[model samples]
Target: MELKKILCAVDLMDTVNPAVEYAKMLADMSGASVSVIYVISSRSTYENLQVPVEEIAKGMRRIWSRSREDMDAFVAAYFPGVDATGFIYEGKPAEKIVEIAREQDVDMIVMGTHAREGLDRLFFGSVANEVVKSSKCPVMTIRPEKKSE
Candidate 1:
């Protein structure tokens, strides 16, 4: 299928580069535009009850601002001189990703897989797995390269 636009979901972590590079390669090959998205999960916004609501909100704002800067740097690093738009959304990560993909009408969704297992996977669940299952469009997941000993 011809890809006019591609949606890339990143967490602005170590996994981001591989996913962004893969998406960039695909976009270059297919002559498609790329849109990068970072989701801030609602659960991440919660803190100690004694912190106070105002403090929580202020902390969230700081987090958002820092995240935005990181996102900008990420795109610049991976997609220099390319016309890629970056987006930030707040909610459950996988759900927001799928929703944005559908809303944007992208041809494919690109994301990174952390390859969690056992208890960790069971407790936290896999965002990539959820996105793959729920996304209306095709999902391409790039696993981070194994680090050498």
Candidate 2:
């Protein structure tokens, strides 16, 4: 396939992920531009915050700023010597990822899956699963290799 753009969704929780490498490989082969996206699942309005409005806004800005920093670091660490765009958004991760992919007209999306099961899966929905279901373009999900006992 002739891929012009790719969106790679990464959660900063993990120090490393195989999905990044997969994205890089695909981009290298297809000559596609890669865009890294990280979403902060935070409520838009901090209704519970008793602090002043300015303080609340400032706090939100700080959080976003830190996220941007982390995104930059993640991109640099994962995609050395390669130019990649970074995007940070505040909202549900799956929705935001799909939205960004659509907006950017990406040809494919690459992301890592935690492989949560049973009760954990029920409690915390799978962002990868949701993105695959909702995304307009093809999505590639990489699950980390299981350690041998």
The candidate that achieves the highest TM-score relative to the unseen native structure? 1
Off by over 4 Å in 2: 44-58, 146-149
Decoy 2 TM-score against native: 0.85
User: Over the stretch 14-93, how does candidate 1's per-residue lDDT look in tens digits?
Assistant: 54345888889888888898999999867344864567788878888987999999988888888876668888888989
Report the CA-based lDDT of candidate 1 relative to the real structure.
Answer: 0.83
lDDT of 2 at 114: 84
Give the Cα error of residue 106 in candidate 1, in Å: 0.4
Could you estimate the TM-score for every candidate? Answer: 0.89, 0.85
- Candidate 2 lDDT over residue span 39-90, tens digit each: 8776544746566878877787888888888888888888876658888888
Locate the minimum summed-lDDT window of 10 residues in model 1. 41-50
lDDT of each: 0.83, 0.83
RMSD per candidate (Å) reads: 2.5, 3.2
What C-alpha lDDT, on a 0 to 100 scale, does residue 30 get in candidate 1? 87
Model 1 / residue 50 / CA error / Å: 5.7
